[model samples]
Target: MDTPLKNLAIIGAGAMGSGIAALFASKGLNIVLIDPMEGALERALKTIDRQLNVYAPGGVQEAMQRIQVSPGLEAACNSDLVIEAVPENLELKRGIFAKLDSLCPARTLFATNTSGLSINAIASAVVRRDRFVGTHFFTPADVIPLVEVVRNDDTSEDTVARVMATLRFAGKRPVLVRQDIPGFIANRIQHALAREAISLLEKGVASAEDIDEVVKWSLGIRLALSGPLEQRDMNGIDVHYAIASYLYKDLENRTEPSELLKSKVESGQIGAKNGQGFYTWSPERRERVLREKSAALGELAAWLNGKAGGS
Candidate 1:
């Protein structure tokens, strides 16, 4: 039998790291959150505290008590699992993995919360490549249920199984990604849709708001319940094939980022983080949208959980 994962060490105290730490800690697992930057630990703890107060009010103190913040990498030495959520630079990740490889025990499982980096290359930095895997959690990790568990060529079966079990125990829906492909599963599909959306905008086919409305009412609503392939099967494979045959030739297949997006970035209108992008976002508008999205996701998460339980 495999050993149960009791303690986790997250090696970044940014949004993703803190969110992940809060998630495991709330599930009764001990977490050590480490970052070398000044005030990072305090900021992360504040964020975790605020999120817990909003979502799990009764368990805020208990969860907070389970997390220990440290400014050194050595704090992760005794952890059962170590997850690196650093910035998306290849060399930076490699450096961190090398340090972690030397500091952590041989039995410790190492996972990277990398979005699109090569898992094989990252695993190569560590001595125990077989114990290294990828655990890609979405933004607002505590709220999102989906986690892409990516296994590379050298990742052992035991490593995958243990990581999957731990994620499931933490109330996450972990999907194993067999290959170390760019963007993994979700982001690949998401970017395909985004590319087409931007293509339409660039060609003046429709306003961004109208396109968004169409997607939300049409594709988004259905996808909330059933996945694309499953929906395609229900709609009839023959019909899907016929539509694909006709539409495939005309679909957007650009290898480069859309000029519209580039221009937006050049002009410093880089979406909600700033003030505008494809759409203008005032501070109030951004807050309102975030609140609405959070509430909707919360409701959807509850519904999905209930559905899974019934099954």
Candidate 2:
């Protein structure tokens, strides 16, 4: 779509922002990495080079000239699309969009890399509400293949379809979400397992390792071949409907933290990002692990493509 998103701007030079910039540039798009912080824009560009070499060596090696580093909001105003990946805070995100709304052309598509924000709220800051969409990329965008293309009530069908096609051309799985709600589809399903896993830990039901092992060995295998909705049909809808009727409440967030999770997170056991969570590993080691996961997932994707009669 749109000739592989020929011009893209990733505003903000944070981790997610740089990752997004790298992904577009690696896909042979003209990319602008924008930020105002001292050295932030430069650092993000360097990080893009470093990350691309790891995520898509062949593509980035060939498309290394596609990226451009810029230090202000004005640099992104001319882009075809601008993806804001600033901090998780709402006011800051709105502020960026407000400025972008004033600066960018009416045709420029504005997207957010937010994980949990409401798409409607984000769109309110932009003038072209019909052109704004939630383009959520997973961590390390250049490597991760699945991108959630979200559309709220204000978004136009053309924008949604264009986003889907652009991402598809970039060689990513674009999951179309009909309705834009909090957490969207994958995250709702993700949090379901997360809450249950934490509950098991709090109740002394099983260690985190054992809990993860069970899911990874079983549900993970089934998911590898088919998604949850497909698995439901394969396993029989009657059984799923019965189970859903019985276990529906288990999916919701009943407790805030149960004190145990609160303590774990508050005490700096905030997972691999901080070298600890339920597991421990050095930051460098963790990146290596994630790279391995990316390679494995990429191979699976490639094989799946071949099976589906794709080159």
Candidate 3:
């Protein structure tokens, strides 16, 4: 079935929300991006314009024409798809969905851009529970291809299909998360790696710089080409099993956040956004890192799209 997602409404003007708006606009869909905070709409418009130039330069004018900025929920009343990209707080999300439920049409699909919140809990606040789902887009939503389309118990198969189809139409790769489990799929795997990485740092197994180098130079590249499961197959199940049997026991199985990480945050060294975390960052250094990262991601995405068989 063709996607029924022409009138899209994104109810936030932050990084993820703006990126999503730019992404939809680039795909020729009319978008209404809403946020009530002063100057937020302006920022979102600028962000959309900037991202469009980077990702869809040839169509920037046309895409910008299709995007409208709003500071009110009423603008989304006629939307076919309403994606809530507000803060990750459950109460905040529930309030927005409740308000949207009253304002939007019954047929409008409601999706949350929550990274790890329970889809079921969020859907409970709205009457159209079956229409509620989660579309967890990664940072730089316009560039990232993977979107987790999460479903709650009340969600219908038709809702899932429509969301997947809509994402595919918008030039995204959507994966269905059948259950509303915590950390759904990618995040669960990500945190597993993070826990171990942080634990390694805490134990002085390696310096933070060296640890990152290992990840970026080694694990990150190979994992992009083939997933862990596929790699296990290639390495022989028996061999992997033998290693995992012993390795898993030695791996970090901490239920709590790493003390080393807690200490960094406690001291206000909260990464590039600030000036320090694992590494110190000057404005120039941060900008360079961001520029280099964006370039690398763009290159990787292009290579994957063109020659990686849509990996």
Candidate 4:
């Protein structure tokens, strides 16, 4: 399939939307970022500018020039592809997809930036379900290299191929998720690890700090170089089997959210955005952590690129 991705309409100006716009714009794709809320477009532009300065200071202006913010969905009618990054509300997404289906051309591909939502249910709101697919980008989308390209039962092969190609062209490591299961692949694995972490905390197995340090220095580093399945093989499958046989029953198997997490949300200590969560976050500490994380991801990206080039 040829790359039919050029003009992109990003329909949301929140963090995820703006970050996505910056990522594509930096790769020379003209973007129309649409949001109806007052001052949203301006805030998104500022965010895009700030992020571009960090990622590509010399070419910030060039990238900014490629982004055109608008206050309505009509501005996206002429786009080749429309990526909806709206808040993760099923009704809101359905409404947006319904409108876009009526306004956009028949050839335009529709993709969602949902972290873990039903892609088929979202596509049901549109007539061209074959053209709709999930393009799940991680938080801080500009820095993350992984993009989960998800396809539902009705999604066409051509749509999957073209969407993957577009992501690759935009400098992303696209992984094909063959099914429309909730959480897809990455989030399933991620939340499993998170559940265990929280379980340990609740059981007084360790403090949050120690638990994070253990993962960050051990499984985290190893997983970065080799995935879980590969690492298991490297460690000897017999060892894994022996451990799982004894420990699987003891692991956190609750289907509901942990009480600790529920309480944190109920108290409005959501995370870095709210200045509190598992760790207390002062303004300075939050900024420092954000900077450190961005820098670390940048370094990892550079190392991965070098390795790929060498190979």
Name the best candidate (by lDDT).
Answer: 4
For residues 1-311, write the lDDT of model 4, one tens digit per residue: 85748899999999899989999998899999999999999999998998888888898999999998899999999998899999999999999999999999999999999889999999999999999999999978989888999987789998888888888898888999989999999999999999999999999999999999999999988777788898889999999999999999999999999999899899998997888889889999888888779868977887977886612
Off by over 4 Å in 4: 2-4, 308-311
Quantify all predictions' global Cα lDDT against the true fold. Answer: 0.90, 0.81, 0.90, 0.91
Q: After superposition, how far is residue 276 of candidate 2 from its true place, in Å?
A: 1.7
List pairs with backbone clashes in candidate 4: none
Model 2 spans > 4 angstroms off = 242-255, 308-311
Model 3, position 119, has a per-residue lDDT of 94
- Provide the RMSD of all predictions against the true structure, rounded to 1 decimal: 1.5, 2.4, 1.2, 1.3
**lDDT per residue (tens digit) for residues 19-100 in model 3:** 8999888888899999999999998888788777776889999999998888999999989999999988999999999999
Model 1 scores a TM of 0.96
Error of 2 at 245 (Å): 5.3
Clashing pairs in 2: none
Q: Who is ahead in lDDT, 1 or 3?
A: 1
Deviation (Å) of 12 in candidate 2 = 2.2
Instruction: Output the worst ten-in-a-row residue range by lDDT, candidate 2.
Output: 249-258
Model 1 residue pairs with clashes: none
lDDT computed for candidate 1: 0.90
Reference-based TM-score of each model? 0.96, 0.90, 0.97, 0.97
Tens-digit lDDT string for candidate 1 (65-92): 9999899899999998999998998899
lDDT value, residue 242 of candidate 1: 96
Indicate the TM-score of model 2: 0.90
